[model samples]
Target: MEFSIKDIIEAGEGYHIEFKEFLDKSFVEEVCAFANSGGGRVILGVADNGTIKGTHTDNSFRSRVQDSLRQLQLYLDIEIRVQDNLIIVEVPEGSDKPYACSRGFFIRNGANSQKLTRNEIIDFFQKEGRIRFEELRNEKAVFDNDFDERAFENFLNMAGVSRSIDRMSLLRNLDCINDEGKLTNAGVLFFAKDIDFLMNHAIVVCVLYKGTEKVHILDKKDFKENIVENIDNAILFVKRHTNVQYKIEGVQREEIPDIPDVALREAIINAVCHRDYFDRSSNVLIEVFDDRVQISNPGGLPSGLRPSEFGRKSVTRNPLIASLLHRINYIEKVGTGISRIIQAVDENKKSSVEFEYNSGFSVIFRKLDRTSEADLGESSEKTKGKNAEIILEAIRDNPTVTREELCQITGLSIQGVEWNLRKLKAEGKIKRIGPAKGGHWEVIDYSC
Candidate 1:
């Protein structure tokens, strides 16, 4: 395309335009960056100040520039032309993305060519769907020896598939096994005997701070299990640290968590499903403070996905993992998790959830302020005891009630009920008369 020098100068340098005074090694980096990201034009005869300083337009120089680009690992086809004594090189967006030269992987950021870090390159590969970690085979993963049969069976039942099918056939059909009968990464993540040993970074780290800062850690847990189990365990951890309020809805008493269950669940699932498995530096994190809860994952939104498309578009970084979750009904729909979280928060009349992203993605849910009803200096123990009372009543109603049963009866979660039970037993208010299976509860003192 022909462009007037006046017009090119008027446009200035941007994401799709770079100005260079002469041909240099940096031009290759610029070309690679443009090819990796969106296509852009490099005016070799132009100065950084937008002053036109013409370069050699000889056929030999043109041939030299073309040869230099060809030296890259991936051959990129660029358009070169001489316009009004200036060398204009047009680098198109690469079809085979993540283009790199001898220098390193480069991507255009604003008007500059920024080299990608090791983690950044892996993240870029994941976002572009170039490298699917879930599809890669784990050499140590054996189909029968290292598989968790019970977990696989549970998944099959949830997916509504019959056990009559041969185990190998079923696994192959699910794309969890390769032609060599070896398990894929997804298989290892979902049904491995020891997920932590094989994929340590797949775990979820949960922390409860005393207040807003990290000065005091009230509780901490590292859940290393199958991806599905990790999600559930993480949610349970959040429930243990947060508050619950009871409401009378006609004949039923409704229990409401400080952060809506739907929103928290969605955030947790999103974190697990979309996280960059290649990034072993950090696992999915669930941090609970006095005023907010944050769920963060290694990689942010996929490349090419605009912030405007946050909840509207569907793009799977780990298709195999997402597909398996979908089969088990863990995920209802693709690209709807964010919207569901927002809807749940709105329905609960809670503060809006904030999404912060860069190298990592974080979903922060603000806790509702319930302190207005009480005095300014009132201890939080009073509010906690109020919720604990509901658990006490549930235990009184059914001495043989299980933790799950109590959760259903009082709207308290499994971890919440467990925490309350521990506190009750420690205070000598309630005692377990027998083992877990046929345990009966005895109330020593009903007063809170």
Candidate 2:
């Protein structure tokens, strides 16, 4: 590619561009960094302040520069072009990533080349999918030592698999065990008797705060069970804390959670399935505030996925874990979780869900407006007089109906149904027969 030196100066140094007054030994590090990250062009003969000092160019000088890049372990084809007095080196993004130099492993951070620490290098490999966390065998994990037979049996039942296949055979078929007979990390997470003991960061932490900020905690629960159990329990915690309303359709009443249950469930499942298992410091966090509920996991989106293809693309960081979950019907499809979450929220007419991707991935479900809840409550009360007539008619139709049954028949909460019943009895419209347990509702005067 051709470049005008004036245009390069105006562009300055950034994530995909760098400026160097002259080529030095450090130019090799710059080349490696660009290849490791998004590919960028390093312009020699350009000063740090965008001053084009220009470098001495000859056939021998170009050969010497090429020789320096060859010192890298992996051979990279760098596009070297001499424009006027400036030398431009265009390095394409490495297909085989985590490129290194004799100095150390380096990556482009903003405009600079930063050498990675030992742990950072390992994390980079995992993020690039070069190393899968689920496939790695846990040295301390033994099938007989910590495997929960009951949990495994429950999973088989849910998955509709027969117990005719022995446990070891089933495990092997599922890729939960390696040839050495040691359980893989995926197996330990899914069937371990105590995941908290086996892997501390595999649990789910739920917190309910009094307000938006994390100042005062009203309730908190750390679920340290198998992956499925943790997901279920985390959802249960949210349901207990969030609001619920009764929706009456004819004679049947449905309890609708304030935040759509399907959306919340999908978020939780996505978090557990795609979270970074390599990061042992942080667990999946579910935080509920007065305004919103945020669910976050350690890892962001998979490496190759672009922002535009976020919900549309299907990339599994832990294929083994995802496959196991899919077998048990926890996940319906590979890449539909995000879309399903959005659809659930929209169908419920709840506030839109927000997705954030940084060092970690987060889904925030906004709560319904307080004013809207008040309006709904007001509307329900206004229709209560008519609802009372419906209740009376229902009691006449079924004299053996219980209060709980009235709740179902009338499309009201237990408390709402009870209040209506009490008002009817006070008006001499209905009565109860026998004990509360076996009692039936009776119409007294049969007047609305």
Candidate 3:
């Protein structure tokens, strides 16, 4: 929705970008494909291969285009952007999907659009869960009543969308509101001032315990704010309770936590991104114990993801929600959160993370052994060798990596990293390339 025409032309037509040399009746069919799938742009006068051959269309053509969509009964406005001969039609996704024209239901498949038959329609609904909860229109959501200008501004700033676009048009383009100005479920989660009455179960509850059990409570908080606030607050709650080791490098100080912040944040986001919004029974839970921190959301693993395929595959139960989060840079476009969490914890020298999705998906991060960490004055040869190995692997992965970053990745204090780097340099295994500020490390030998 925030894309530039020049960029669109350079990128060429794809699933989200459809090239049309002239205005034709088949344009409605392209809209059907966009509505059924993710919303995309239909650029008129552009060649299929992205050659910009302009075409002209006035207000009457736009009116006709809007009036022609009556057959679909979708209350979505077809946005038409004019630039001399080039006309761009911004098609918002339909709330009621499986959108079809005269021929059949069309779905976007990469650079092409496919028209599905009757049998395919049924299969499509079954495979895609009929309708996503986030895309549904909330009958009770009145834009005047539920709109949170602050949250909307936050989203716009974070998403890099300009404020010049008409508020309603921007909302419609973002699939947050229908043509009727009604907010969609995704809209409510992100922009609603208060979802307590709208979506009560969407809350994120974070609790800290004295021990590994549920007997004593150290701190408890129920974040009933919007999705963004809920995630930030939940992570803040855990960080407040978690321990961090301080390491001083000259005047600069680095604090390495008991768990990697990246891993913890990813785990929390995965919990929210994959959790079933349809299930209003349980809120996402982030529990910090003395020994470990457990984060769980009430949707096992979406329908398609298998036990073995979870960390390797990318399948989202809430596509719209995932897209929104992705726009804000909260997570990756790929399904690498699980593998990332595992790698982060392993690199930190923390105990292995336990992933469970029996009743609901849960990520458990085990706390480090503080006693053994303090006793690093004299470690066994095997322990020293293992630390050396972790450091080498980390350095290989990132040559420009600093000592502070090494502290985080190796789960070592400043002192430990200094000791290892000294040993590695003495062993002639690794050497600094240049000035510490603008330099890199060069691995001199193959051996540790």
Candidate 4:
């Protein structure tokens, strides 16, 4: 926060900096605004017009300022410093927000401190993490009309909860439903079918672009299923469009993706778990270009998370949603997602990951070049990628994806999908791991 006094005065006031000729009751209001929003500095001896007007920094003046600030009951403490005739007052962002002086609740909007209306104050509280959306009950979501039995059952199995428990007791234990028989937002998001109808912005839209820019679209899919399903399908969309090279190591075969799927999956899960469901204007997005893959979600880092401690600390905006994902093993633990993504990318040594935040959070993965692809494979020359590769990617995306589901994913007929499945099995590229009814496909091949 150290800065040149001359430069600051010349630059005038901004969002985080204000200038005042002297300390007054309104000066306390400015401090209140700064504490309510981002912490800022107010120069006591400088006028609003940037003229240097010398003011006293004696004990009497400091006592007046301290008394006025105490009226706000602010957790933010102000620090005073003297630079010649100028007095610098440093206001820290409040640990307990909604700070206000006798005037009213004021927030710094650009260079000015504006008063907050009742609705604005409520919105501010929500933004400040006071009112959480996940824990709120959605009275509109009827249990019978919106619930997905299969999805709920799958969740129970994945979470290791027994079906012997009554439905109400199970849901209550999971904190999905209230005693009033209404579903929580977390419950609806975790098990509701066609969730977009209830929560329109609760979806993930994936797109594959032709080049580095967003000019041309090659493929697109919208996932409006349950939150967990949205994460899974969004990941599948990525693998479906990326490049992979097959390699041989003794008796074992490996399929190395151009970008690490582990990192990508972690990013996707992080987006869904941390996205601001309060925002109806934007949905989670997965965009793939020729050079990199990007995943974005509405709302940046939460209030408690500092920019410097981003990857090192974990602060989730949606704790219940994170808990559900954690139970299903979609999230191994809280706060380790960023580190895991970094670890996966580092180990793969093909692509690198970058993160950006502010109003929105985005994770970008730089693609490995084609030369690296050739180096990892059998020969320098490229082979023509066939249906087998797409099928294998689909299998990798979801080993439990059924034949009929394969037809939808591949845009192929039943006969065509069966033929490729048989061919892949006969060639020792993939195999059915269990009985036909509950089986999954496993890849063991060196073909692209």
Highest-scoring model, TM-score: 3
Candidate 4 residue 316 C-alpha distance from true site, Å: 1.2
Question: Candidate 1's residue-wise lDDT over 416-443, tens digit each?
Answer: 5566788889999999997988779998
> Model 2, poorest ten-residue lDDT window?
369-378
Can you list the residue pairs that collide in candidate 4? Answer: none
Task: TM-score each candidate.
Answer: 0.57, 0.56, 0.64, 0.57
The sequence of per-residue lDDT tens digits that candidate 4 reaches over residues 1-448 is 2336775565445555789887777888899888876577888888887789889878887778778778775556679888888788899878787776778887664456767653555555676555458767886799989889999989877876545556765665455776577888888898887688878798899999875557779999999999988999999999999888888999999998967877988999999989988888999999997668999999998755678989985556675677668768898877789999999999988788899999999999986544533232313223214556778998988999887677566554444566668867898999899999988888888485
Q: Which stretches of candidate 2 lie over 4 Å from their true place?
A: 1-126, 370-448
Least lDDT summed over 10 consecutive residues: which range in candidate 3?
369-378
Give the residue spans of candidate 4 off by over 4 A.
1-126, 370-448
Q: What local distance difference test score does each model get?
A: 0.77, 0.77, 0.76, 0.77
**Cα misplacement distance, residue 63 of candidate 1 (Å):** 46
Instruction: Count the clashes in each prediction.
Output: 0, 0, 0, 0
Which residue pairs in model 1 clash with each other? none
The RMSD of every model to the true structure, in order and in angstroms, is 17.1, 18.0, 13.5, 18.8
